[model samples]
Target: MMTGTIENRDVFLANIAKRFGRAPKTEIDRPTWQYNPQNRVLKEATKNELVEVLVEQCKNIHTDIVITNTANLPADLQKVVGNYGGKSVITWKDERFQNYALSSLMTEQWPLENIQLYEWDSEQPEENIRQAEKANIGITISEITLAESGTAVLFSSKDKGRSVSFLPENSIILIPKSTIVPRMTQAARWISEKVRNGELIASCINFITGPSNSADIEMILIVGVHGPIKATYIVIEDQ
Candidate 1:
């Protein structure tokens, strides 16, 4: 029988969260929106409709929308983005998912020659943030360690800057199907444990569930008032 030290991950996370002053709540109840896989539910709708849905969420507040598909971006839709004065950016995950390529923003045929790529690193978060501001669509990779709550926990310590995901007009996350999880608590626990063991540390960690939104203005529904007004999660099954 193989025996080893079993870390108290939950407790460890709790302590880390407490120290950070942003510990998530204990409430574990929420409605779950199951993304059907067998039929590819998202594909049922026209790509235009999907873009409309994302655009409507912005309420004409933000001009740019970020995305993460480059290699095989929808042609017609890409044209729309181009006409709309959108900028597309490119990002690729590490060796783990090297085959995947992503592009964002521009609707028209992407100028493959003009596309710029960035690798995840810690030292240039400020520069990344500056670039995100200039870009309408900010695309990047996800660590995807925690899957519950349809969240992607990206690391921006030195490899990837935190601002790459935040501080943009629209934030689109590309999460492989394998990384989805059922609860935010599970993610919190994992983060805490990792930090406790010196596996991860950073100035900030962003937990984005959906697009940037707030309805606090006199009960008026608003999105992207503060951060990226649009949030789209492209859940691609492991290939």
Candidate 2:
């Protein structure tokens, strides 16, 4: 049976090579193309320009952008939650969030008296995911922000999971200005370097541009088909 399977695979490869009008080459070409023109212009973009572009592009895609300082982040988040009337909140338990003292602020603003707040728990993943699904608002910290596409990059791990971003009705991401990159290429390079340095790489890296949408059913555009109905980005000027 194994011999027959190998023969069938060889025949399939031969057929593909014949269709392409070339013999199957066993070895790949060395020194692949490395020049990327898109990165050149991005390299020249100023930090302020990148911020402007990100905000503009995000707005074009129906994502709201709020620029504030680190001290005002709590206030900004309060406003976002208030606008959506979010009662149930799910958030990442990242160190950056801890340094910002966001949990205390959130508790003060949206107390247990009216709202329910849940943090990501590694031990109780299933229960945490269920809580995330029930939450009206999901809050997460972005590792990188791509200005060219207005995309926020999130690395999923024990402290931060993918469900927190997708299961909620509204998604709120906090981005530090320092983490904003010019484009996806730069972001990729950064991630690659981190992995090369033996860092604890995440199982999944999610690049979120805007709120989920689809035009598959009768060509009518529908938002929140696969993810959050609304996406909001809060860019902190100083980390």
TM-score quality measure for candidate 1: 0.53
The sequence of per-residue lDDT tens digits that candidate 2 reaches over residues 79-101 is 88888886888888787875665
lDDT tens digits, residue span 19-48, model 1: 999875677686766863534433444444
Residue 229 in model 2: shift from native, Å? 0.2
lDDT of 2 at 165: 97
Show the colliding residue pairs in model 2. none
Evaluated at residue 144, the lDDT of candidate 2 is: 91
lDDT of 2 at 98: 58
Instruction: Give the best candidate by lDDT.
Output: 2
Q: Which candidate has the top score in TM-score? A: 2
Q: In candidate 2, which residue ranges exceed 4 Å CA deviation?
A: 1-35, 106-109, 217-219
